[model samples]
Target: MLKIVVLVSGGGTNLQAVIDGVKDGTISNTEIAGVISNNKNAYALERAKENGIPELCVSPKDYDSRELFNEKFLEAVDSFEPDLIVLAGFLVVIPAAMIEKYRNRMINIHPSLIPSFCGKGYYGLKVHEAALSRGVKVVGATVHFVDEGTDTGPIILQKAVEVEAGDTPKILQRRVMEQAEWKILPRAIDLIANGKVTVRDNRTIIAE
Candidate 1:
């Protein structure tokens, strides 16, 4: 079985989606080994506890520098010995060392189609706000490998959602989540866990 470790920093809605997918047979051949959060009070920790998965809380503030925190963070995550690391609403930049070690072994779900409304400063409602401000006719979600560059990883899967005229940031955020992120993230996880995805030349080739 593929063992997965999830990183989160919020209510864990995406984390829940993965859990539900695993439970409902939508995602198979995977076990969520653990969940790690930077926020001690993050509800994601509660979700992990409820599911009987090992949970770890490591605050960046505890460390004097981002470098130190990165070391500790990588150590904590590697302790679980996960075959795959899923960044589900994890709201921080992963350390370069960790990214280098993990390589294609880690993945993240971004709330935009990527290459547009992605990269630094394009997260949470800001992505939707930017899309709306740009008067985009469509918005979507992307699941990609976590690379050294922000959101510039090889795309594993993408699902687009229409942007309605009257959509506010919050409303658009919910729509994208329901229509895209919730679906493709688990699907991408399943693909990777099942060995249906291959990375080559900084791109992904999904096997048929």
Candidate 2:
């Protein structure tokens, strides 16, 4: 089985999608080794528990310094011996050492089509806000390999959603999540777990 550890910081809608995918065999030959959250009260933890998957909270607030938090956080994730790390809605800035260790084995679901409303300061509803401010007609989601730089990773999959009139940031966010994020994130995990994905020259090549 491909053991995966999921990281989240919120309600875990994206995390739930993975769980559903695994249960339905959409993501074959994979098991969730654990779910780790930075927020102690994150609903994602409860989701993991209800599903009988191991869950943990490693918050930076509990540590004296960022370095200490980073070290302990990495240690906690390493304990699960995960083959793949999935950042579903994880908000914490990943430590460089952890990123280096996991490299292409780690992937994240960003709220927008990268290189547009992506990179630093673009997450959650902020991405939608930017797209609306720019008056773009199409907005979407992206799944990519995690790298040292912020959201500057090899793109795995992207799905675009139409931007409707009178759409607020929150409205657009929901649409993107429903129409794109929830779908592609699990698909990307399935692709990686089934050995249908490859990273070369900072891009992903999907196998036939």
Candidate 3:
């Protein structure tokens, strides 16, 4: 079985989706070895504990520098010896060192289609607000390999959500979260697990 490690920093709705997917055989060949978070109070940690998954909080605030924090975080995650790392809603900017070590082994789900409205300072509800403000007809989510750059990794999958005329950031976000985010994330993970997806020349290729 593929050993999986999930990282989260907020409510664990997406994390729940992954757990359910694995339980139901939608995502095969994986066992969630651990769940890590930067916030001790993050609700995702509670979910992990409830499910009997090992949980850890390696807060960046406890460290003197980003590099030090990254080292500690890497140590915590490496303890699991995970085959894959899933970022459910983790908010921190992971250092390049960890990115290099994991490379295609790490994956992240972003709120926007990416390369468009993604990077430092663009996260959570802020991404949705930016899309809505831009009057984008289509807004959606992306699951991609985690590279050194922000959301610039090879895209594994993308699902679009239509923006309604009267939609607020909250409303649009909820719609996309349910219709797009929840569905595509597990599928992306499954693809990686099953060897149906590959990153070649920084592009994701889905095999038949």
Candidate 4:
């Protein structure tokens, strides 16, 4: 079975999606090894505990520098010997070392379409606000491979939500997240696990 470690910084809706998928056979041949967070107060930890999965909290403030933080983070994750790492609402910028170590095995689900409303300081509600402000007819979420840049990895899957005229950030986010995140994240993971995803010149090729 493929072992997975999830990194979360907020509510674990996506994490829950993964868990439910695995349990219900939507995602097969994988086990959630553990869940880790930078914030001790993160609600995701409770979700992990509820599932009887081991959980760890490593505060970035405890480390002297980004390098140290990355080292410690890697140590915590390495303990599980995970085959893949999933970032579910994790807020920190991953260090290059970890990115290099995991490389294609790391994935993240962003709340908005990439190359649009992404990068540092563009997370959660901010992404939704940006979409509404831009008057985009469509808003959606992306599941992509994790690289050194913020949300710039090769895309694996995306699902769009039509931006309604009266849509508030919250309303738009709710609709997009329900369809995009809960659906695409698991599909991306399944694609990787089944060897149906390949990176060709920085693009994702999903086998038909």
Best candidate, lDDT: 2
lDDT of 4 by residue, 1-208 (tens): 8789999998889999998988898887788999999999989999999999999998898989878888898899999999999999999888888899998899999998888899888999999999899899988899999988889999999988889888999988889878789999988887777788888888999996
lDDT of 3 by residue, 41-139 (tens): 999999888889899899999999888998999999899999899999998888778788898999999998878789888898999889987888998
Query: Could you say which candidate leads in TM-score?
Result: 2
For all candidates in order, the CA lDDT equals 0.93, 0.94, 0.90, 0.90
Tell me model 2's lDDT, rounded to 2 decimals. 0.94
**lDDT at 116 for candidate 1?**
92
Clashes of 1: 0
Structural similarity to truth (TM-score) of each candidate: 0.98, 0.98, 0.97, 0.96
1 versus 4: better TM-score goes to: 1
Candidate 2 per-residue lDDT, tens place, 1-208, comes to 8899999999999999999999999888899999999999999999999999999999999999999999999999999999999999899999999999998999999988888989888888888889999999998999999998988999999999999989999999999999999899889988888899999999999996
By descending TM-score, how would the candidates be arranged? Answer: 2, 1, 3, 4
> Model 1, 33-80: lDDT tens per residue?
999999999999998899888998988989999889988999999999
* Model 1 C-alpha RMSD to native: 0.8
lDDT head-to-head 2 vs 4, winner: 2
